[model samples]
Target: MAATGLTPSKAGPSRPSAPREAAPAPPGGAFARALRRNLTAHAFLIGAVLCFAVFSWYPMVREFFLAFQTTENGEVSWVGLDNLATVFNDPAFWQAWRNTLLFTVLALLLGFAVPFLVAIVINEFHHAQGYLRLLVYLPVMLPPVASVLLFQYLYDPGYGLLNELLRLLHLPEQQWLQDPDLSMLSIVVASTWMNMGGATLIYLAALQGIPGELYEAAELDGAGLLRKIWHVTIPQTRLVLSLMLLMQVIATMQVFVEPFLLTGGAGPEGSTTTVVYLIYQYAFNFNDYGAAAALGLLLLVLLAGFSAAYVRLSRAQDE
Candidate 1:
């Protein structure tokens, strides 16, 4: 062999140097490409952004401006807290708040709790689940006005189905929408019937997602039905429950249509009058937009706080 240090070793003919493959271009290179991508994404979002701006943001901003301004003979002038003062000074303000509070309490007791309970019961059924679900949800599919009008007729004191049933059961006749003491409760029942389906469906979905093993473990520990629900069902579904509670509070606080259509907006002795109905009266009946906006602003603040709490709770659950 020639001197090993001086000669190249030959295993075979040296393979021709392999051509280097070019690296794939960075997905849209960093700067201009990223800008282009952002522009495209924003372009796709533009329609939704514009819709929210026009319908949601603009209305909210306009309401805030309108709340402090007054129009006299078509001339608008800023009046600061005068509009707010007018709302505060209205004789119906406290009564409206009181009635609204009562409606909210009744709605929570009936509307919020009943749906969750119904959902729980439905979750335990082994047969005809679909039929039951349809039965529960069918009312939600009906037009709201039609449902309200139907409930209004059903609540009539004389010659109504409810009274007929009561009579058959030997129960005393109820004035329903006509009775100051019973009107709000009657509206709560109607509103609950019309609205509970959505909440029930949501609760049902949440309940289904809960691990069956949890209930098995509870039962293995000798937990009874109520104890199993308290330990397993409620704990597992607490997040959904809390969210629904906040939503119900916000919704019930702003109730209007039920009372409006069922009881001529105020009911007997204004027992069913709500803050939203008061706003309606100010805006339409009195043509006092400023006062309406101011009252709406107050309601908006309260709802905003509830919404914020809901968001916080949701985020906590996610974390």
Candidate 2:
């Protein structure tokens, strides 16, 4: 007998599976078992959704239904577009609409552009960035009442600090808050001061995220500062800018508090009568919930159009 270089094997040539990749080890002790409990997770998620439906969606749907219904003495009745007809027919509605448009446009020009430019400037400056940020954000921490009251004093017709400063610098002492023509402008200025801080912070974050290398390369290729910003920074963060613009338009379109607090709902000659103020008047002063809800729906439709446009733009960019 002779021993050969062979080993014992099962019949049929010992076929075996190519090394079975280790089964992803079942997650591990208690944590793994808990995670696999889909019933618990699904139950919790459905409960959360139901809560939202009850609290948010139900209220919104109710508002929609009420928009087409009339109420008298705390009782509601179906009116079928009478509220819409009334809203369109009312003279005040046009005025409110005009004021809302004006506020939105002015705010974008005065508020949005300033913060964006300031963000760009701050991103460039090596010194005072933190100091300037803190200084700008300080207004945000101030209560709106305190801030408005402070502005009232500053815009006072007599012995105001700003008037004195204007006097000292040889600038005309304009009646800021009192004049009907100047009242909306005054509110815009105040709101801009308060609102610009957060916007500036968002833009600054976006600006900082832009790679310095892009600018360096652009400069190396003889591109100037404006060109670099136009070509590089603008394109790089256009999404954030568009998002902020939409938000600012929506927010500024609903300007109410500043005008209400500053000018007592409507300024001299109804100059600062914004849409939101009008809605508040309908809902509270006149007890016309239907009209208020109708106006709200109008705003929702307009802003929804803007949001839909944004979604399309985002999707186009992704593609």
Can you give the TM-score per candidate against the true fold? 0.86, 0.81
- Clash counts per candidate, in order, are 0, 0
Candidate 2, residues 180-281, lDDT tens digits: the string is 778877889999997789999999999999998999999999999899989999999898988898899889988888998888887877888888888899
- The top-ranked prediction according to lDDT is 1
The TM-score, computed over Cα atoms with residue i paired to residue i, of candidate 2 is 0.81
- Compute the lDDT for candidate 2: 0.87
**Best-matching candidate per TM-score:** 1
With candidate 1 superimposed using the best TM-score fit, by how many Å does residue 145's alpha carbon deviate from the native? 1.2
How high is the lDDT of residue 269 in model 1? 89
Candidate 1 lDDT over residue span 1-319, tens digit each = 5555634554457779989999886675588667776897878699889999999999999999999999999999999999999999998998999999999999999999999999999999978779989999999999989999898779878888899999999999999888899999999999999999999999999999999899889888999999988889998998889889988999999999899988999889889889999999999999999999999999999889879987897888789
User: Ten consecutive residues with minimal summed lDDT in candidate 1?
Assistant: 2-11
Candidate 2 RMSD computed on C-alpha atoms after optimal superposition onto the true structure: 6.6
Residue 179 lDDT (model 1):
89
